[model samples]
Target: MDLLTARIDLDAIAHNTRVLKQRAGDARLMCVVKADAYNHGAQRVVPVMDASGADAFGVATLAEGASISELTAKPVAAWLWVPGQEIPPGVELGVPTLDHLSWLIDARVNAPLHIKVDTGMHRSGLRESDWEAAFRMAARAGLEVKGLMSHLAVADDPANPYTDAQADAFRRAVALARQVGLEVPVNHLANSPALLSRPDLAFDQVRAGVGLYGLEPIAGGGSDLRPAMSWVARVLAVKPLSVGEAVSYGLTWAAPDNGFVAVVTAGYADGVARSWQGCLDVAIGAHRYPQVGRVCMDQFIVWLGDNDAGVAIGDEAVIFGAGGVGATELADRVGTINYEIVCAPTGRTVRTYTGGTGA
Candidate 1:
């Protein structure tokens, strides 16, 4: 079997969820397991989340919501809706616009639904101009209005005033719903950053997205999160390169000194993005080594310096996770966010889960 794997610490996830819940105080925790729990494998994340007291699970699509609802008894809500996607039997849906409500009414969608308000983000939500029509139409159709939700544009930045403004607007929108005779039970506008920084925004529940997976949504928030996913592969071969010798593909990187190279059976095809070639480092146990040469589709070369490198075939090379190259560091080096780094590894790599209620 391929040695490349993404070992997940479900315990860390549970810990993070608990911490987030603690931060939220009285608000229920909505573990956003969308994008396959940001590619941490929702198949493994959902059950453990329930064990950790997650009030609900948030997914991005109807299919994802349906998949998880079949696995756990907790409520699963799909926030983004396309016109024809099948709304699963009990899965809550995020109703964004009058058109979405129209489709829900036409399809006879008889599940819990939250109204998305476009208070300030101008994203997918009911507009201020369309709120009355949406509320009235939904009421006319007897659609149960379970909650009122809005997406924040700058909740991640503590210095941004938009969070306050958005929260106020969200409240105003909810008040408008009340005026229209709709009882909006759950009022949620907080994502991870908002939950960690602005507890006032956590009305009924907070959608803890990347934060639950131990990747911080805010710059300093990672200090509280334990990285849940680790990427690793085993060394396939070790060899020495002469001072002037070039390395893999187009000779992009060459041996500056006499260095030993360990070829690991993991590369872009395995979710190690090609852009990581000249920039990323992998860990052998706790020792870090620079990756040389252009990363291949199936393998990459790590330059272990001199004889002290002491690496051999069959040794594990950790790409990122505990005691290894962390996802946050890799994200900074790659000029992207940690969300992509953790979600990078696909199912092509083996997933070994550890540390949780299941443990």
Candidate 2:
């Protein structure tokens, strides 16, 4: 039996995909499976998402795009790539810079691509000053310009005016691209937060990333999305601790009273951030226990106050998930985000799937 495991509910993924698809309305739904579906095992979840309602798939790298390209016949587009990388066959590309567009033209690469315009994100994308020039260049090279794409600078906050500003800028880019003789037909700019909040910004397609995995990007937006991942560890041992006795490395914490502590089989090496020590509340059976002391390389201690729930050595301890604290709650406690929470369970952690029928 694996000591640490990430229980992935495939049904939750399907439900989230369908919900996003419905939210997209007339627009297409592009499921972002980059970072291995945000470290949720894209190989397993991509098929579920495609079977549910994914119109396309997006990834950060060509390799990532290539990896999941065969999972679904739907088009896979990768946005983050260097100039010299070999373009994988059957995967679409997102031209982020004028230099990348020029490289593709010079190399005579014949692949469908989306022009990533810098719509105020100012991260990676062709600048507005070069939009017409780049569009003309792509048109002259006879490059198949699939559409335009942009990233939102601040869409998580519905109250943030930057999202609307970015939307307007993206719209202008599309118009300029068309004016410069590039069709730029299927343009998109909205991410998870924007897709959840602003349907008007969905343009031709909404790239649903975290929401596909059931994470509510907008704080307290309260969608019916179900969280899909659960990080769990096995209880290794239960030891009694005296009031003044300390535990683990640095001896940072001591038993407040004469109670028992359960040693859980997960630690920093397993993606449990050392900084998360003292902020985690592990759930075992029906009771919650406080994670005390310093986190170790392979394990940590959870104070099971009198062992009230009878947590045994082999009992399952939920670090975060359906039964324990939600990923968002744990993120708030650890000063991180739900995305990182789901991506945590690594080193020696086994993954298992459940409920994929979307029932």
Candidate 3:
């Protein structure tokens, strides 16, 4: 069996959901479970959401939305699209452009729809100039536009004015839609960062992704969100290393005279990034062990610091968890976002979930 494992704390997910719901206040919470709950395994996370009283869910594709729909009867919306795609029944679709809107209108898809407005993100969405025409056409075509939504370009930073500007633009788009006689049942513009930083923008619903997993969307900040996923592995060997002995691919790391090197059953293929070498450390029981040398494709070595560090071959090594070495710390070590760090592990790595009403 693969020694590498990812432990998901279902209770932590539920706690984060409750925290997010509180932050949302009067606005409904739409848990964004895209990318398999940021690689935390949505099959397990979505159920936790169902029990947590989430109003709905938002995903990147129809497949994700459909999968979530199977888990719960709550509303599920898919935002991404192909030129011609089949949106499953009872699933809401996000219209990216006016042309796409026309296609849905022509098809007479009676399913609920959320309109994406470009606002200031300049990414994907219907332009402000086309919102009136799109809304008018949708009304004429008898399409059900349930929500008006937009993405936050840079809300992670509490000081960034771009998010504020985007919020304003989104409001204007919604106003134009109303003026054109389109009934927008809900107006949503807050992602995780915006939801936490700007409670005022949590109009009708808040799309929270990373925050639900206990990883902060903002850098070096945000509320008390606990990380729900923990990457772990078993120590396969514990060997003595002389002060001058080199290790791994580049032989870049040398043992400190009294220290020993530990072999862990995980590497780049298991979602432990290669860049983690020399920087990241793992928790051996309650102690910390520093990773040495280059992380290999199948395994990596850790420095026990001393000969009697009390670690053994069968001991568990926590790469990151709610305690000890955490996801936020791991992300910083690799100069990447916490989202990418938590999502790094692969299917080859087994996932074991704990806590919540059900496993």
Candidate 4:
């Protein structure tokens, strides 16, 4: 095992999915496995996901959809940010592609296709008037209208009124698609936050990404889902520091008093953000130590204050996950979001999957 490693709780993932399914109630879930399952290792985590009764899987790219098919041979549906020209392999393996009206005819695969509407999130999808044409083209191209979906820009913010408006727009698009003679079986427009905060947006299928990982995207974080990823690193060295001594770069942090400081083997290069300087804290055994300086490429120092002895070289310092610190907590401390925390981890770090309730 590497000194710095990410422990993936496979059982926690299964548990989280089951919890989300329950919360979603009547809504079918297309588990968003995009960004490599939010950096939890999509390929490695799919078995547990399958065992947990996932209705379907969603990814951001066709490559990811292909990866999903390769891993489980399960029905994988993907919403690509790019247009139709960038489609990848394995489209015949029951993976659905999503795009705007212009690219509707480009989805030449045998599987059903989805039409993405730009409801409010100005990122992807077709405009309102173009949606009907898009569905018409897809139907003519022999593509089954699996669903009509859109992304929410501010579903996590309860105060944001745009959520309802977006839901309404999605409904109108579905109505238009059905008018065009397409079987608009599923209509989805909810991400993790929307799924958690707005029950009304739970259409036929809800796409959840962050919630499955157990980090609340909504305000004042805490969700019904359990955390599935835990990052741990070893304390490589411990040094005695005087009150006036500064730590890391630019002298950003100074010891409060004479105490021991432990240098951890992981840093920004390992996904600990640079903004974590002097603000982040890690748990070693039962004690919490403050991050004392700017996170370096591969290392950071934690101020031990006046305590010592229990924490030594090789002692595990937990960054986030079950039986550990929360990513939401770290993101809040660093003035970022849970999504950044989930993606910040570098690929070099070793991952160990701890099988939970499922085999």
Relative to the unseen true structure, what is the C-alpha lDDT of residue 83 in candidate 1, on a scale of 0 to 100?
68
lDDT against the true structure, per candidate, is 0.85, 0.91, 0.87, 0.77
Candidate 4: where are CA atoms >4 Å away? 81-108, 357-359
Please write out the lDDT profile of model 1 over residues 1-359, one tens digit for every residue: 55888899988988888888889889888889888888888888888878877898888888899998987888888988786887678899998878888998998889999989898999799888898899888778888998888899988798998788888888888888888888888878899988888888889888888888888888876447888898889999999888989988899987899878899988888888788876778888668888888889989999898848578889899888876878988999989889888888873699888877656
**lDDT tens per residue, model 3, 1-359:** 44888889999999999999999999999999989888988899998987896899999999898898998889999999865788798889998998789888777778898999998878889988888888899888878889899998888887988878888898898888888788797879999998888999999999998999998788776588888998888999998887889899888888768678889988888888787887778888878888999999988999887846589988888888844687888878888888888888884689888998776
Against the true structure, candidate 4 reaches a TM-score of: 0.90
Q: Residues 241-261, candidate 2, lDDT per residue (tens digit)?
A: 899899998889988899899
Candidate 2: where is the Cα deviation over 4 Å? 357-359
The count of backbone overlaps in candidate 2 is: 0
Q: Model 1, residue 339: what's the lDDT? A: 86
Q: Write the per-residue lDDT of candidate 4 for residues 140-201, one digit (tens) a residue.
A: 77677678778899888888888888888888988888888888787788888888888888
Candidate 1 regions with alpha-carbon error over 4 angstroms: none
Clashing pairs in 4: none
Candidate 1 shows a clash count of: 1
lDDT computed for candidate 1: 0.85
Report, for all candidates in order, the number of backbone clashes: 1, 0, 0, 0
Task: Give me the displacement of residue 75 in model 1, in angstroms.
Answer: 1.5
Tell me, what's the RMSD of every candidate?
1.5, 1.2, 1.5, 2.8
| Minimal lDDT window, size 10, model 2 | 350-359
